[model samples]
Target: MLLHLPEGGRVVHEEHAPITLPKGWFRVIRQREYVPGSVRIVAD
Candidate 1:
């Protein structure tokens, strides 16, 4: 999975050591441009 940021930065989830997501850092999109099950990291 490739995590794309708003600032154009990207985090690639390689086969080894995928990122352990923090709590309350993901957004669930039911509909829209974003794909289902795709997570967008929320900025604090």
Candidate 2:
């Protein structure tokens, strides 16, 4: 899905880009390890 924003508006802001995994979960690249199931919250 994609969303377009024009200028600005009242809203909460967050961003994420992840690589899909075979386990039906995804992971974001970072310097350190990511605890298991952590992505689930972000997915929600």
Q: Write the per-residue lDDT of candidate 1 for residues 1-44, one digit (tens) a residue.
A: 33434444333555565454443334544433445777555432
**lDDT for each residue of candidate 2 in 1-44, tens digit (9 for 90 to 100):** 32333432333335655433233223343344457765332332
Off by over 4 Å in 2: 9-44
Q: Distance from true position, residue 7, model 1, in Å?
A: 26
- Best candidate according to TM-score: 1
TM-score of candidate 1 versus the correct structure, residues matched by position: 0.21
> Residue 4, candidate 1: how far off, in angstroms?
18
List the pairs of residues colliding in candidate 2.
none
Best prediction by lDDT? 1
The Cα RMSD in angstroms, rounded to one decimal, for candidate 1 relative to the true structure is 12.7
TM-score of 2: 0.19
